[model samples]
Target: MQGLTPTESISFILVFLEGILSFFSPCVIPLIPIYISYLAGNAKQVAEDGTITFHRKKVFFHTLFFVLGISFAFFILGMSFTALGTFFQSNQLLFTRIGGILILILGLYQVGLLDIKFLQRERKFQIPLGDREANPLLAFAMGFTFSFAWTPCVGPALSSVLILASGTGSSLTGNLLVLVYSLGFVIPFLLLGLFTTQVLNFLNVHKKFLKYTVKAGGILLILIGIMTFTGWMNGVTKYLSKFTPPALTREEENLPPEESDTASESDSAENSEAKEEPVKTPAFDFTLTDQFGNEHTLSDYKGKVVFLNFWATWCPPCQMEMPDIEEIYQEFDKNEGDIVILGISNPSSAEYPDNADKSKEEVLAYLEDNKYTFPIVFDETGEVLQDYFISAFPTSFFIDKEGNFFGYATGLMTKSQIYQALEQALAATEQPSE
Candidate 1:
């Protein structure tokens, strides 16, 4: 939570809400009584005069174990999705398109707009517990087993959320999103543990409402798919960011300039001196000016690895990762020539007709307001943007010491990821020209 942005917080909340909705799916809700009965075991007591009671302590413990099992399955699923997201981070635009379309289709299926045979098929493990007392272990196993049972009903909503998880910038955030979702889904179960009899009765009486849950979930998924596919989620986040607290500075946390300089010197000294044959493949070189009126040409920095970040002021992901970039820039001693971090932008003009249209003055003021010192060069003619084939807002290219195009990663990257990328670029041999 140290650097949780307003946009991230909002996204987490939305995911959590989706989890809550999943719990109310038609498959899960109508059958709650049977599940609770199995979990409750011998805890239930009945007396004359139609009175009923449950051993709250025993029931709560059993339910706790059961929910934990569900959480375990959910966590594993989240990790898988997060890993997929990381793998596809370099082609985020394509991933977004595919994920969005898949979610939208699932939404339609859920809403009865389309009938998908496999989605309707139930695949649950048969665990017979007839005339047997349910212990904590049994409850836990059953909970875990039943999670698969509920999948057919919850798949649409859960899959949609997982797709979003796959698009997150880091595994930590992605896992946390799943955790929040699990909490939303399981909180009701925990509440049922505490008040088993009342909850069962209430659900039974209001069973009619359960049928609507799928439609509502479908609508929600549709909205999410549209937002993600069109990249409008960032715009919404940008708007809400105005209401959040101002950005916090991490100056005290960063390494001092002297120490950073010494580290850079050590890194350079330790790097391999035996040179391999240089490849003729060269990066597209261009001349541009930074916000501070400093002119930088790509070919001038031949012996240093360059982290070239293409970004725009209007891009939320770009803005989200700037602080991390700033930290790297400072830790590498600002522009010491061993490793250079630079940002590339294009102001709105006929040459570059796109959503990012902030003039040079606006870009400067924005940078000044945020106190970002990393050098950003303006591609006035938009030639460099085209040369790079930038299909997304926050694409980055790594250039090796020989001025060869090393590699590129699309979307947001954490500070550690940036460091790893720089190291790879520094260690890489010159590539053959295409």
Candidate 2:
């Protein structure tokens, strides 16, 4: 899989760090010591003589269970924020701005620039019904309750996850994405809990780092907020979409039967009159490489009917028409006519203007994945397409035997339409030989 961009990687790291810091906010941090003390209540005092200082594995498991509960609670909160953003389409921008501002405020709070009284309000939301006595399970319940009640404290981290989820285009994927994000936060909390005393001691000695860390986080939130407000982030995403290839247009589709028949009659009458005159045509030839790296020349297949299909990997209609082309190829393969189907994949690359660096291997993979077995040629330089002045995808040209251009189609074609064109080419080529 392709790795994420530098910006995406940095953003994810910031979000993960924000989660850990939120867990250590003043409202939540002091309570961790209280909860640990409660869980170790009489056990620690009885073992003060060092006779039974170590807790059993059961105690550890209970503590971990509480951690799981907190993670799940946060995950659900993230889901709710995502759902709220998705349900109302008209106020999407309004909600996005609100979320961004909320994140900015939380960041400022972390830097001690702002203090909201509501941030300190804590309620006993998670009641432990079964275990009134202190156990690891009760501690877990406390952790879960803390996650729900401390929403204002961790708003920045939660907002980041909700923003990511909203962009996923579906609520289900968004919810799961936040769950993964919660894991990013939960892992550190579990580790800190395992060695709480050591962590507190380390924090005391390196207290200066906390201020700088919070400032750095604040700056990141400010940048994200600015980008969100100005729509620069969305613009960047939109600009990237230009790399996608163009699709077929409706005007390029063939005319209906009545019009087609009239046009055909007019052309036939004109051709009958022009038969008495002589015409001169330029010699056209070129060398190109197929997807397999094999070279082919137009001159080599001189006395044959060749359907040259010019297309690109990114073109959706081009992708759709491949099967019809393949069916035509199969029919012609068994016929007496010297027919050949040649596919030219137009090149596109970031380095090459108007072309992409879509490798031959990648093109082959796409074809194989889609079950396309046509003989495809590569045109990384766009030499063939430019030479023919072809501007649309799936442009097909019928070259009769003896190298005469019979006719062409500029857009998508059905199986019947292609077969009819092939029959016309066959007739045109047979007339010269007869």
Would you list the C-alpha lDDT of every candidate in the order shown? 0.63, 0.53
lDDT tens readout by residue for model 1, 240-325: 33332222111112655355435544643443233222223357689999988899999999899998998878877789989999
Model 2, span 1-434: residue lDDT tens: 01111111123444555566656543354345334434433322223563323243433555577678777665554443345422433243454566456545555655567777643222111111112245666667766655544443344345445434433324454556566667666676566446533544444456577446546666655555555555443333223433423321122235674565455557545655655422212124678887666787877887777778777677666777888887777777722358888888755554444443266667888878877666787777655553454444556766767675555554566677666666666765577421
Clash total of candidate 1: 1
Candidate 1 regions exceeding 4 Å error are: 1-280, 350-355, 430-434
Error of 2 at 74 (Å): 66
Clashes of each: 1, 7
Best candidate per TM-score, number?
2
Q: Please report the candidate that would top lDDT against the real structure.
A: 1
TM-scores vs. true structure, each candidate:
0.37, 0.39
Q: What is the lDDT for 37 in model 1? A: 66
